[model samples]
Target chain A: MSSAVEEKRKHQKAQKKADRDAALAKKAELNMTSLMDIFVNVLIYLLMNYSTSPVDVPQSKEHTLPQSSTKLEVKHTTTIAVTKKIIMVNRKKVCDVVKNTVDPSLKKDKQASSYLITPLFKELKEDVQKQKKIAKYNPSAAFKGEVTIVADQDMSFRLLSEVMYTAGQAEFSKFKFAVVKKGG
Target chain B: MGKKIRQEDATEEINIMPLMNIIMLLIPFLIMSTEFIKIGVINVAAPKIGGGASSSEPKKKDEKPPLNLTVSITEKGLTILTRGKKIPEGCDLKGEATEAKLPTVKKIGDKHNLPVLKQCLQTIKEVFPDERRIIIMAEPEIRYSIIIDVMDHSREGKTADKDMFPEVVLSAGVL
Candidate 1:
């Protein structure tokens, strides 16, 4: 038979260890409800904004396009982006825009007041010739004289007209403006 | 006191393990495939420098004179003109008139009165139902959004069956 004192000591040690283990378990329990709520909300928001579009117009704070309800789909063609500080043809920087106008040094004949952007025109002409050459070689890829203009919403009509006129001079007959489609 | 339950009990009110797994797989997939800003296109006529459309010039005497509908957007407001003459605000487009009042639609509280412009165009559409082409001209300082807004207002009515003008010819401001 075991002594009463020895039995009492053994029971006391077992109870203390059980209590410590219970406290540790309680402390380790994690509440996952709040984390799950946040994730679900974010997922729902992202899902709502999903769309399948082919036109990959680079969007930034300074290069936002005007919104419109036109049902016209964006056709892939030569792209000319007119941002706040620069003008790009087919994602290649051609000239700089200062105060909503092409740089004077980049104008035709280097005239400060001339609207024809010489650098832009030259870049567009090169693209046109390349497209014509490709069309000549391959009957399937014919030159359509189409160009997409992705311009900032607040862009001045003067700059837009200059770009349009310069593009026309470069022999791009069909013109299309890239816009953010609304009313979806 | 926060008590830890015994090991062998139901864990949650609703099991979300499957949902979490699906979300983990979908979030990245959707992020790659989605276009947050839907990009579209609006076709506009290119500005021709020398000469354009001999048919509209009316060289032959028997050829009917073109209506030549044009909307000029200025800092003040939108002005609808046909055949080099302005159509008065809230007035009808006569297509061809010898002497008509000045045609200008005043802005409504620093904004172009688009509804009034649409009403005026509706009256003009009645006269020239077959005419689909219209020229748009904007001043140098005019914002590009205003031009797009005006085009939207002039392009269609409440329904698809009632299209106002789809053929938009952009003028180089001088024309």
Candidate 2:
């Protein structure tokens, strides 16, 4: 009788071990099919929207760009932004544009002969010199003298022309106006 | 032989678990780095300084000079001038023509006339398909934003689905 009781206890122990082993195996098997499906969808969406162009101008509250239906792609270049009250180059304030006109103090040349703003011209000239020096060492990269202007819509053409003229004097001949894409 | 066959089958099953792990990490990285705002550009050439003639060809006595399209922005509305002559009564945006000069007070809803100016430009574009240059004249008090909007309309005829005048020359309104 004791032998039979021992055999029955051993059988119970084996069954409990089997049950625990089965539970662990079930827990270890992770179904990654759903997770993979989600990842693939997200990857495709991001890849579709990815832009190969290098220029990425950050928009701010003070300087809102005008909307347009142009399809020209913006390339990476030096940026000159004209806000309601100030003019900036690469996020640095070069001078002030007050009430649709460049500040009188900043004007070096008379309005009739030249529209080049003094402080802006000096700053842009330095930037061009620095870029040219960098291009000398890096043979693969060349300076294109390209610049983008981001000006507030409410500002006058006088300010825009002054900024463009100053940039031209600084050896920046190519001009591009940064605008928000209309519709989508 | 049976054990060898089983080993070959196991090797044939590609271990994609590592690839899946890498993809999972890349998705979040790309999502964070992606930019939302789409930026575009309008290429513009600087205005020429002097009025020197480019062509050396001798002028004919009866040959009419080429039409120079100029859109002047005033306080009342837009005035479309072609070769110094105003086109017609339809180009005016204030519902009536006002001969107001510069430093005139900008009225509300004055920008709504841009579409009318665009229509006039479209007709001119149909006549001269190759003409891509336009002179934009604005008052000193005119906002920069309005000038941009005018350029946007004059640069391309959106309704006509054609390039009207992409070259814009900025000038002060003298009339």
Candidate 3:
């Protein structure tokens, strides 16, 4: 009787162990495969879009940098980005833009349809003042009146000139147009 | 039974901790390395505020370079002008610029004819080898893409070793 009881106990224990192992394996199998696949995909995407440039602009769906064969490297400066929707000065929203041009109301001299954008000029002037203040403390880091204009390839030339002309009015003289470096 | 449960728990915990650690490290690494877009620059001279000439140097009276190379883009097409004189292109060979202009090169589509434009600039380069500056002007409605493409095409020829006119000064529209 004792030996028979012992055999019954052993069989029960073995069945319980098998059931536990099977449940654990099922759970792990389901999660591991899908999770691993997801992680691998995410990592690949991140690797491809990684950039090494010191200065960069976020390229949106509507905007793309014009391709250039020139070997000029982008320098750090006050950035003015013109999108289809709006114009930005140093990553701050300055004014709204339209399809082919800026709204006249947003400009300084609205009646004349002036090229000088009011908000952009004010913002850039503030930036120049701040830079000048910083330069005063550190003589070696004198302010350079440089501005980088980032815009879509399809943006109109008139808007570009307006931005440059306004920047010029606000003490910025050096103009650099951002582009994607590529072969012809 | 209690000892066996503890051992299983330990193994499960170990499996997740290492994986979590790895993912934690990897995610930050990828994020730190990622930037939205890479961009280069084309240094363009600021438009002359109140200009006699867009050139950086103050002009002497009655003195001008032999070639005041100017390239203009309008609704018609590109018109390369030297000292206000247009460079006429193939078959449109009339003495008058307005009468006969450089027609857009047609291969598959109505593109800017950049390569042919480059070739014309190259020809100009041979004679005015010392001239490094070129003024680019376009109509108000012209796309910035066309302007920059023209600038890039004329900036370098074949390679960086062969520069055509790297210095570009943007001029206001003719209109």
**What's the count of clashing pairs in each model shown?**
2, 6, 0
Q: Give the alpha carbon lDDT tens digit for every residue of B106-141 in model 3.
A: 222656777878887887787778888899888888
lDDT of 2 by residue, B33-138 (tens): 6767677888875554411222123544645565777877777767676776665555432233445431222334645466666777887787777778788776
Off by over 4 Å in 1: A1-50, B1-26, B50-64, B94-103
Q: lDDT by residue for model 3 over A55-171, one digit each (tens)?
A: 567788667788876678888899999888888887899888778688888787684358888888899889989998999999987887878988988888888888888888888
Q: CA lDDT, every prediction?
A: 0.81, 0.72, 0.77
- For candidate 1, write residues A89-130 as lDDT tens digits: 999999888879777778888886677898888899999899
TM-score for each prediction?
0.77, 0.72, 0.77
lDDT at B70, model 1: 91
The Cα error of candidate 2 at residue B17, in Å, is: 5.1
Please give the distance, in angstroms, between residue A112's alpha carbon in candidate 3 and its true position after superposition.
5.0
Docking class of 1: acceptable
Q: Candidate 2, A94: how far from true, in Å?
A: 3.0
Pairs of residues at least 3 apart in sequence or in different chains that clash in candidate 2: A153-B144, A153-B145, A154-B144, A154-B145, A155-B144, A156-B144
